[model samples]
Target: MSLSKLKLTTCLWFDGNAEEAANFYTSVFPNSKVLHIQRYLKNGQELHRQEPGSVMVVEFELDGHRFVGLNGGPNFKFNEAISFQIDCANQEEVDYYWAKLGEGGDPAKQQCSWVADRFGVSWQVVPTAMKDMLASEDKAAAGRAMEAMMHMKKLDIAELEKAFRG
Candidate 1:
């Protein structure tokens, strides 16, 4: 049987730091690298604007996923409507990402999720089993789990499980 896989690539647009952001991401994730780099040419003449050979486009892979970074100028900025969710297995994982990504950014609390990072990207660092526990058949159990999650900035799986079982 042939199965069709849905492959989605996220394209990130930056004012002029697409290359910088790609490098930063590759450093943070394992099995990541800058596959290709391109520079912009204007009428057969390389523009000596800003940094020479500054990243026009960067093709990179992070954790086996492909992403394209476009230095499409600063016409747009990232908003909270679209965010990345990081499913963590434990508090250690949560703390590590929270600290690293939250550098030079503001933190906004939303249950077990927060918005941080210098790029103004929002990340939801949640426990791995949070969704399963939250979707329990028992309404009271699920409610309890949600209640616990709502009070936390970083998800605690142990506490969520406790609430689910109680």
Candidate 2:
């Protein structure tokens, strides 16, 4: 069967802390919630279930994307190769996300479009008007806006528009 036809889901593997991480994520994003949780038990006795309180699997949705969190033991870690991008309308949105996600995490400078959160989850927080401006017929304006954007940590839509007009 083709992978695309197999009801593909993004499965996140956590180091024995799937439940905690899921809850944390749901709290951070709007319209997010933990859909269901499953526990592992053996025979008549709950082995991993009764100890350490690890979650076998947690189904959740963040900003409408369905994801599964598995307490698969710390066999892997999150990397920047894959990341979630947030398109914001203003600086307030950018700052809010930067502060919330950057807590306890390192931030990598990527102009006004990117930041890596504490959990090694990289995010690109960009202005919603970026596409419109970049697609403008005015090449000089688009280039100027792009230059301005490349120097910011958090995108400012107003500033970009100003640059575009210059």
Candidate 3:
């Protein structure tokens, strides 16, 4: 949705890295771009503790999703509780995102198609077919798919389909 039409947007807090993070995110996905940037002014420097002209906020969009990245200092940090889910249509799509987002990320956090990026932002590179496979009317098939997915870090759609058929 366009900025004016949108009612809500995700705001990410960063410790003076909002601009860099916004650029990184826009580079990762197609149809993404940085919309605007707001810098700290001399008047607000006392409260923000930032140099005048330093980046304060960056507005960006990633594949149609709008986000505001704020240089809100280190008081807040990102955790696994909140994550962006990317619906991939195929293994190739999943692999692309997995490699891109997982670069310099915590390896231990890579589980169930979930990865915490270098910026400590969590993302789930999931296959589009996963929901349908796990929601099938056939309980046996659904259970098999679910079991297979549990052990996967980067979901393998072919393997999930095989488990569903079994």
Candidate 4:
């Protein structure tokens, strides 16, 4: 969606690395770019304590979804409760995203297709077919697929399909 057509934008709080995070995100996704970067000014220096010229907010879009990264300071941290999900069309897409997003991430948090990036942003990389596999009318098939998925870190589409068919 175009920036003008965006009804709501997600603002992500960062710790003095809003621009860097925005660059990283834009590089990872196709059709994405850093739309704008705003730096801090003297107006709120006393309250924010940020360098006058330091990055304040970065507005960017990832495959049409607009996001804002704000250098809101060290008061907040990203948690696993919230994450972005990438639906892959096949195994190749899944592998690509898993490796890219999972780079430099905490290994402990890499499980069941969920990965925490270097900047502590969490993402889920799953094949598009996964939705159908896990929601099939056949309860037994769906259960098998679910069980197989639980043991995986990056999702395996072939394995999930095999289990579902069994």
Q: What is the C-alpha local distance difference test score of each model?
A: 0.77, 0.78, 0.93, 0.93
Question: Residues 51-74, candidate 3, lDDT per residue (tens digit)?
Answer: 889999999999888999999999
What are the models' TM-scores? 0.82, 0.79, 0.93, 0.95
State candidate 2's TM-score. Answer: 0.79
* Ranking of all candidate structures by their TM-score, best first: 4, 3, 1, 2
Go through the candidates in order and give the C-alpha RMSD of each one to the true structure: 3.5, 4.0, 2.8, 2.9
The true-versus-predicted C-alpha distance at residue 75 of model 4, in Å, is 0.6
Model 4 lDDT tens row, 1-166: 6567438899999999889889999999999999999999999789999989899999999999999999999999998999999999999999989898888888899999999999899999989899998779999999999999999999988999999999
User: What's the CA error at residue 69 for candidate 4, in Å?
Assistant: 0.4
True-vs-predicted CA distance for residue 73, candidate 1, Å: 1.5
Model 2, residue pairs in steric clash: 105-118
- Give the per-residue lDDT digits (tens) of candidate 1, residues 64-164: 88999888776798877788887777778877777777777676534366756677667777767777777778889989998988887767677888888
Whole-model alpha-carbon lDDT for candidate 3: 0.93
Better of 2 and 3 by TM-score: 3
Q: For candidate 2, lDDT tens digit of each residue in 79-119?
A: 87787788777778877877777777665534467777655
Quick one: how many clashes does candidate 2 have? 1
